[model samples]
Target: MFGRDWTEKDQSVIEHHDYSYIVYKSFLKYLYTGVISLPMQELLELLDLAIVYCETKLERCCIQEIKRGISIQNIDFLRSIADKHKKEDLKIFCLCLESRNS
Candidate 1:
């Protein structure tokens, strides 16, 4: 993790930004406990955080979300994330979709 001092950020901005309270707590829990309960509604963002934290094991729990019941926009996001993370299975999934579309 890049050590920029996140604590000095203005409270109002932190509160209103895309980082929700629940996600914030989860991140803190991950920092302290190395474990977290994934709330269903926040799975996608949580997966992104997991990737950022190098928590690949935690990220796998939501891989199915990246693989199914998705809109094109989200599929694109997932593909980008997979590419960033070098997640081979996600790359294969996107490749299968590309082959289907062609």
Candidate 2:
């Protein structure tokens, strides 16, 4: 850990290989502005970032965006994501969507 009088040697660079540059940039923008608008795939990537960083608000926002774009084709995939992330709201929402469509 760097002390109060940090120097260039104390600087650190974190890397995220799984996320695209645009997705990472949008995440930083969202952190400052509390706003994000991106395609569903990018939103999913952002959701992963949020989960990794424990950003519950951003995670909720991403889930809302995913819900808006959800369809029969993507329900399973999204549900799996919800399950993987332990997002009960999203899992319940996916279930409701499935039931409604049935």
Candidate 3:
């Protein structure tokens, strides 16, 4: 991480070297407004970015949104993401949902 030696102008020019433009912009908006309204299609990618940045609150929000959007067709994909991210709670939730629908 960059140290505290940066000027305001330097800060302005400092890119979010960790995330994509869309993900970073959405995250910045969430920081400002505490809300994000991106399409479900974008949630997983944002979740990955949130995990990488150690943004626990943002990860929780993403997981909630993913739960709301889940369906039989996407359960496997969601489970895979949960496993990949070590989100055991989400993995359990997805498994329960899958069992209920089976």
Candidate 4:
């Protein structure tokens, strides 16, 4: 581990967060603290954090939130997230979910 303390001193995430940072931090935590509290957001970043980390569960949770409109406004981003998680079959499901609301 780096000499620097890995404590979560910063605000949970980057103000302009990206998929890479999310995955990198998730890796760091699993490697260090043995805890993985996924970030909660009013708006999920369009960048697919799970694709980068290859964490299907997290991707699912985030996309679900987006479809619920409790998160960001980026269908393409959600689609990519779904595709990355080997959930391409879910694209129709998600699209259907999205359409029902609108």
Candidate 5:
């Protein structure tokens, strides 16, 4: 954000203290190579970062990975995350999986 009225416009160095170094590095790698490699926890954080940065392609990739790792044990957790993030596709997928399992 180097444009007018941006927070980082007048700053020389921008800092993002939210994510860990590893997670941020992984996100940068994905940005450059279009490949994502991270554990489930970090992957979820990366999804949040993708959404924040408006990286739709990366966001979709994270969603796909999350779907692949979904299980009955974690369906409720995933549903809650989907609801929190307003990810309708993920919410619907969780609902379908729950219905099938039920």
Candidate 6:
């Protein structure tokens, strides 16, 4: 992590590493509004970034959104994301859904 102390002067040029522009913008908006409104693909990306950044609240929000948006088409992919992110609840939910559908 960059340890450089940020000041008002740096506000104009401060750059975050790793995240794409859209992801960073979305994250900034979430920080401001405590809400995120990305589609599934961007939500997945944001979730990964939240996990990496240790933003547990944001991660939980993303998981909730993922759950709300889950469908038969995206269930397996969502399950994989849940598993990879150690979201046991979401993974279990997905598993149950998959079994019921099958």
Model 4, 14-79: lDDT tens digits are: 343444465566645645764445543422442255546576665565555555542236565566
Model 5 stretches astray by more than 4 angstroms: 2-13
Which candidate achieves the best TM-score against the true structure? 5
In candidate 1 the C-alpha lDDT for residue 75 amounts to: 66
> In lDDT terms, how accurate is model 2?
0.91
Q: What lDDT score belongs to each candidate, Candidate 1 first?
A: 0.68, 0.91, 0.85, 0.53, 0.91, 0.89
RMSD of each: 5.9, 3.0, 2.8, 8.5, 1.9, 3.1
> How accurate locally is residue 9 in candidate 5, as Cα lDDT from 0 to 100?
95
**What TM-score number comes out for model 2?**
0.84
Candidate order (lDDT): 5, 2, 6, 3, 1, 4
TM-score, one value per model? 0.52, 0.84, 0.82, 0.36, 0.86, 0.82
Cα shift from native, residue 20, model 3 (Å):
3.3
The residue-by-residue lDDT of candidate 3 on 64-98, one tens digit each, is 99998889999998999899999998899999999
- Candidate 2, which ten residues in sequence have the lowest lDDT sum? 1-10
Residue-by-residue lDDT tens digits, candidate 6, 6-94: 46454656776777788889998999999899989999999999998899999999989998999999999999888898999899989
Superposed by TM-score, candidate 4 places the C-alpha of residue 63 at a distance from the truth, in angstroms, of 1.7
| Candidate 1 all-Cα RMSD | 5.9
Ranking by TM-score: 5, 2, 6, 3, 1, 4
Ten contiguous residues with the weakest lDDT in model 5: 35-44
Worst ten in a row by lDDT for model 4? 39-48
Which portions of model 6 show Cα errors greater than 4 Å?
1-17
